[model samples]
Target: MDEHGLVSREFTHRYVLPEDTLPRSVSSTLSPDGVLTITAPKKPSPSAPNERIVPIAVQGGPTPLPVQHEP
Candidate 1:
């Protein structure tokens, strides 16, 4: 619970890839309410044999800013 009397929840999802599956990169954006919109790169690369897309949601409070990364 928070000062505003709101309960927080956390969830995580994982993906298992086949021999040909791999990860390329990850990207994310933050909403005004503090929700993060995450996107996994689908483009295939020599390093990434399998590609996966995932979106994570946090239900507690807002962060100061969103973090982003590129391959």
Candidate 2:
């Protein structure tokens, strides 16, 4: 009674959990179904200069400039 057919002790009690002797700057908090998300780490922006340009026959090679003819 497994394979998404449920009944493996009710999918291992809805999802096992009981291991993590903590100790590594310990810090945890998740209420999920009750809403409570937190994530941080973002601060680094200073290096600009890229006008973008790539048109060498659609980048399939050949094009040092020279393919113009307008009459």
Candidate 3:
């Protein structure tokens, strides 16, 4: 880089994304004209819980596990 006269160069480009939401898939394309295009699908909605009943065996007897339900 020093030989190419590009040593110690500082970049001023910054991009920040959401911390909570995330894209499942991402697509990008770079044209011959030095143009970059990025595309992402819409965020998906939360799905219903697949309620599963799990039983645990304790020393005394069998205890039914509790299920967590999000309001």
Top of the candidates by TM-score: 3
Q: Compared with the true structure, what per-residue lDDT tens digits does model 3 show for residues 1-71?
A: 77777846354564554544455566769797767776665566666699566897659767779999999
- Runs in model 1 lying further than 4 Å from the true structure: 3-7, 16-24, 44-71
Please list all clashing residue pairs in model 1, or write none if there are none: 21-49, 21-50, 22-49, 22-50
RMSD of every candidate to native, in Å, equals 22.9, 14.3, 15.7
lDDT of 3 at 18: 55
Higher-scoring candidate on lDDT, 2 or 3: 3
**Candidate 2: C-alpha lDDT:** 0.46
- Per-residue lDDT tens digits for candidate 2, residues 43-62, read 34444686556675456667
Given candidate 3, what's the lDDT at residue 55?
100
TM-score, candidate 3, is 0.33
TM for every model, in the order presented, reads 0.28, 0.18, 0.33
Pairs with steric clashes in candidate 2: none
